[model samples]
Target: MKVIADENLALTDYFFADLAEIDYRAGRGIQAEDLTAANALLVRSVTKVTPALLEGSAVEFVGSATIGTDHIDLAGLATNHVEVTHAPGCNAQAVAEYVVTAILTLQPERVQAGTDFCLGIVGLGNVGSRLAQLAQRLGWRVIGTDPNVQLPEIENLSFAQLLAESDAISIHVPLTHTGQHATYHLFNTQTFEQMKPACLLINSARGEVVSEQALLNDIAKTQRPVVLDVFEHEPIISRNLLDHLALATPHIAGYSLEGKARGTQMVYQAFCQHFKREASKQFESQLADMPVLFNLKQPLSTQLLPLLPQLYNIRADDQALRAGLNKDGMVDAAHFDYLRKTYPLRREWAAYGDQSF
Candidate 1:
C-alpha cells in the first residue's frame, strides 16, 4: 500500500519500509492532490485533517503522530468512513520534563523540599500525571483539578482553590470547544485575577486553552509570569504576548527523540492494525551517539537542580525564538516553522537517569 507521511516525522523509514511507496511532504504544505491517490496518510499537529482536505481523496486511513487530536476533524472523518488514529501519552515523559524545566527556570527557589511549595496541575492525564509524580519526588505538594480523575495521595481541588493556593500552575488538558468543561479560553481575566500574584503559569498543552488577548491584558495588571510552548494561531502568534512572556518556545516541549519516535511507532502500529498487516518493531535511531556526562562537586542530594541544566537548558530555546523575530519586531511565521523543522535533537531525561551523580 502507498503511504504519504509528514517529512518532519522521525523514523518514518523504519515503519514504512515494506510499503509500496512512501511519499513525504511538508505537513502544512500538503495539498489535497497529495492524498487524492494515496491509501494512507500520516501527519503531525501542523496538518489540519478536514473534509476539505480529503473530499476527493482515495485516503482510507489518517494517522497523527501526536498526543492531541484537536487538529483532526474526527466527526468529519468518521462520517466519510476514513478511520482516524492518534498517539496519546507517547510524549508524556518529554512534556513532564519540560514542565520541570520551566518551573526551575521561572523560580529556582521553589525547587527546594517542602509542602510550602505547591504545584497545581490542571489536567491529571498522561502528561500532568507524570509531572505530578516528578514534583512529588522533588518534595512539592501537588494539587490537581481534574474532576474526572482522582489520585489517592494527590489532592484534587476545584479550579478556584487551585488558583488561590498553587505557587505554580501547569496546564495539561485538551482544547475542547463545546464540552461542559471547555478548556478554550479557560485562563481568562477572571481566572488570572484569581491566581496568586506570584503564581507561575506554564502551558504546554494547547495554545487555545488560554486566551492570548486576555492573558496579555491580565499579565499587565497582575505581573504574573507565563511560559507558553503552544499558541492559539500557531506560526501566526501575537507579538504582544510573546514579548510579555517570561519564557517562550516554538511548541516543542514534546520534541524529545524518544518521544517523537514512540509517537511514530504508535501511529504506524495503528495503521497496521487497520490494514491487518504485520507491523515492524525496528524503531531505532542514532540521535544520541554518547552519554551526556554531568560533573558536579556537590552531593547527589544537592546535584539535581544544578545538573538539570546539563540535561536541557530551556533558556536556549527561549533565546532562539527571541532571535527569530521578524523585521517588524514580531515573530515570523516561516521562522517559527523553521525552528520546529530544524529543532535540535533532545533525548528524554530517562536517558541519563542511570548515570551516577
Candidate 2:
C-alpha cells in the first residue's frame, strides 16, 4: 500500500516502515496532484483535507496527528468516502503545562496562586480539565463554564458570569459558528465589558473563538494582558495583535515530544484499523528511551519552578517568534510555518516521571 504522510510528523518512518511505499512531503506545500496515486494520507493541522485536494486522487483514508479538525473539511471528506481520524486529547498535558507556565511567566514573582486567586476555565474538555486540575493543585480556586456538559466539578455559570468572577480566563473551547453556545467570536465587546479590568486572557484553543479586532479593541481600552498561542489566520498573524500580546507563540502549545509521539501512535492505530492490519510496533516500547526528569523529594514549588523551563519555556517561544518578524514588522507565512516546523524538542510534564498527579 502506498501512503503519503506529512514530513513534519514525529515518527512517520517508524510507524509506516512496513508499508510497501511511504512518501513524506511538506504539509502546507502538499497539493492535490501529490495524492493522485496514493492509497492513504497522514497529516498535521497545516494541511487542509478537502475534496478539491482529494477528488481525483486514489486516497481512501486520511489521518490527522493533531487535536483540532477545524483545518479539515469533514463534510467534503465524507462525501468523497475518504475515511478520517484525528487524535483528541493527545496533547492535553502539554497544553495544560503551557497555560500554567504562561500564568507563572506573566507574574513570576508577584503572583501568589493561593485560594484567593480565581481562574476561570472557559471549556471543560481534555485540555481545560487538565489545566483545572493543575490550577487546583497550585491552590487556585477554579470555576468553569461549559454549557455542553454537566460535570459535577465544573460550576455551570454563564460565560459572562465566569468572566466577571475571574481574575484571569483561559479559553479552551472548540470553534463553532451557529448554535446556542456558538464559540466563534464568543469573547467580543459585550463579553469583554463583563470581564475584570485587570484580567489576563489566554487563548490556546482555536483562534476564531475570539474575534481578533474585538479583542484588540478590548485590550486597547482595558489594558488587559493576553497570551495567544493560536491566531485567527495562522501563518499570517496580525502585527497589531502580536505587539499587544504578553506572550505569542506559533501554535506550538501542543508540540511536546510525548504529545507528538502519542498523536502519531493514535493515528497509526486508526490507519491499522482502517486497513485491517496489525500495528508494526508497540507505543510503550517506543517511549522507553525517554529520560526521567523529576524526583519527588524536594518541595513542590522549589522543584516545579526550575523544572518548568527544562520541560518548556513560554518566553523562549515568544522571543523566537518576535525575532522572526521582517523589516515591515510582519511575520511572513513561510517564516511562521518554519518556526513550527523547526520547533525545539519539548517534553510533556508527565514525561518527567510524575504520572501519579
Cα distance off (Å), candidate 1, residue 118: 0.6
Candidate 2: list runs displaced more than 4 Å: 109-111, 288-293, 297-299
**Local accuracy of candidate 1 as per-residue lDDT tens digits, 1-357:** 788899889888877767548998989898898887889989999999998898788899999999999889999999999999989998898998899888887787766756889999999988888888877767789999997898777999999999999999999999998878999999988899899987999999999989888888888887889999998777776667777999999999999988899899998898889989888574664355546453344333255677777778899999998888777768888889888999985888667652321
lDDT of 2 by residue, 1-357 (tens): 889998878877788888638998989999999988899999998898888998788999999999878789999889888899999998888888898899888876424557677889999988888888877767678889988754576566777789889988999988888978898989888889999989889999988888888889988998899999988877787677798999999998888887888898999999999999897675556654556777767434556776777767789899888877887878888888888888875876666776544
Clash total of candidate 1: 0
- In terms of lDDT, the poorest run of 10 residues in model 1 is 292-301
Q: Give the TM-score of candidate 2.
A: 0.94
Question: Which pairs of residues have clashing backbones in candidate 1?
Answer: none
Alpha carbon lDDT of residue 346, candidate 2?
83
All candidates: CA RMSD (Å): 2.6, 1.9
Global fold similarity of model 1 (TM-score): 0.94
- Cα shift from native, residue 315, model 2 (Å): 0.9
